[model samples]
Target: MLKWIAVAAGVLLLAAGMVPLAIIWIESRQARQAGGMEPHVASAQPARRGAVVVYFSRSGNTALAARHIANRLDADLHALEVPEYALGLRGLAHSALDADARRNDPARLRGIRPRTLDLRPFDTVWLGSPVWFYSPAPPIWAFVEHNRFDGQRVVLFNTYNSNIGDDQIAAFKARVMARGAASFEHRALLRGRMTRQIGPDEMLRRIDADWLAGDAVRAPLTARTPAPAAP
Candidate 1:
């Protein structure tokens, strides 16, 4: 009886370990199929002549999306670095705690100083961040808080593991607009366990079709009204 119980326990543990591996394999195969089936197209013209993509990516997933956006828009790319919080397991734990704090008390959140990049020449800025705890990563908030976007177009992008609720989007947008962004747009990619989430090709399509096409931009510029003729 003792032997049977030990065997059962071992089998259960092995199966548990194999579950994640199997899921990964299946997702990888699906990703390959999606990649093969998707066709590439020329990137659309930028909304403005000068543009830049600034992003913070810990797992490289957000970086991939930022690269695609920058390439499609023919813009410069910049990565935000947080060396102290990007090292290993301890770093990851620190990041999670920071994210939680930011979510709860955004005004009090600090640290994560992004490298300074000149934004004066750029009229359009693409900001990207990985979703942490249903909020934009703390590094992203730090970068945005330190920058000025007055009279500039700001487009936001977020990559998530599974879910990205509307409330998170609203919160992020409100924060950016408060910084004096003239216009705002956003796109999100779902990177869940199943592999059909927006890959490179899909991301390009979304950028061209939804973002570059101006569908995502909120509050279009209103034309100046002609003054009534003096009577």
Candidate 2:
């Protein structure tokens, strides 16, 4: 069941089959949230065999959170890189188009494809990406398409500037659930145009399982951020 769901999640992200961005943009978010475990430091010991972090960051916010999580958990990390686009809005735009195109033509997707990430080797995969148009970034969609996640714990981390990330997280949950992951959880780190507060540990602690059940992460923390439009 999980094998099929994991493959489907990645495949769906990889293919649109003539679907447009609006529709894809509209029906966003998936994957249920995992609850119950306290955000304790991953003891100096290694996690289950396949403990790792695979992420895509356009604005660096997601990257920051990914690295922090990796450090706290002492997990292997893999960053999704696209050679052409550097980062920021331009990268976000490119990612948006890339996902749209892939939705239409799965084969059109390109760029470094790893022989394998070996999910079989890890017990959990902390997947990260920046939210775009209320959905996930293209490279992550591509990552999902390329890798196989069987019986592994699949957790999602996202960074967003536009909206608070409710829709985006929801969509991610749906996608992962379809993949039949061993378990899944989604958390959005507030950054970029969004006012970021709370330490990594606190953020992890705040990510209670109940919040995963619904879009109730936190109320807006309106701190004066650097130059940028509202999200």
Candidate 3:
């Protein structure tokens, strides 16, 4: 009777082990019967920069600054470019100079776009340009003029050969703000001569003081929340 009891105990242990195996097998079968599952694959869109680097680079200086700022901001970046076939660098120089001649001119680049840059999602718009004559490049001017800022923040990144200061920047700031941009900050980078040099860090340092450090402010067209209904 003792030996029979021992054998019964062994049978119970075997049954207990089998129960878990049975459960696993049953779950596998149920999963298969339901249907084989496939993993989801996501489609990609164009890279969106939290800070859109909108720039007009005639000699690549402004574009370079735009890239530097994008890197410093730890932001994604994009460049809207003109075809080299349409205008070589030399041609671009002449056009930029002529554009300076028409300083007051506000013509958009003919057929130049992703028509409207979708700056709506981004709170910060990093506006970059090579200062042409006494103001920002014409394309840069046109870009600021055409876009409706509504409630967005604007930061100006400007590069020049030599001889520019608050007069130019203040005017540029006024022009952009007039377009309804909520606010702006100015950064200057010197190009073309070794007489003055502003490395990327210095440009970014100034930009941070003016915009990103969060001092300058603008009034919102609408309150952050709708004002309580006036009785």
Per-candidate clash tally: 0, 18, 0
* Reference-based lDDT, each prediction: 0.69, 0.57, 0.57
- Please, what is the TM-score per model? 0.66, 0.56, 0.56
| Regions of model 1 farther than 4 Å from truth | 1-49, 113-115, 194-231
List of clashing residue pairs for candidate 3? none
lDDT of 2 by residue, 1-231 (tens): 999999998889767643444332322210111121222233245544446878865444456556556654556777777864453345435667876675565456557434247667777788888766566666676676667677777887775555644654665566666665777876665533433334434544443332233431222223224357778
Q: Mind giving the per-residue lDDT tens digits that candidate 1 earns over 94-164?
A: 77788888777887554665546678788888999988788888888788788888889988888676777
- Ordered list by TM-score, greatest first: 1, 3, 2
Top candidate on lDDT is 1
- Clashing pairs for model 1 are none
Position 76, candidate 2: lDDT: 70
Q: On a 0 to 100 scale, what is the lDDT of residue 27 in model 3?
A: 31
lDDT of 2: 0.57
**Candidate 1: RMSD to truth:** 10.9
| lDDT of predicted model 1 | 0.69
Worst lDDT run of 10 residues, candidate 1, spans 215-224
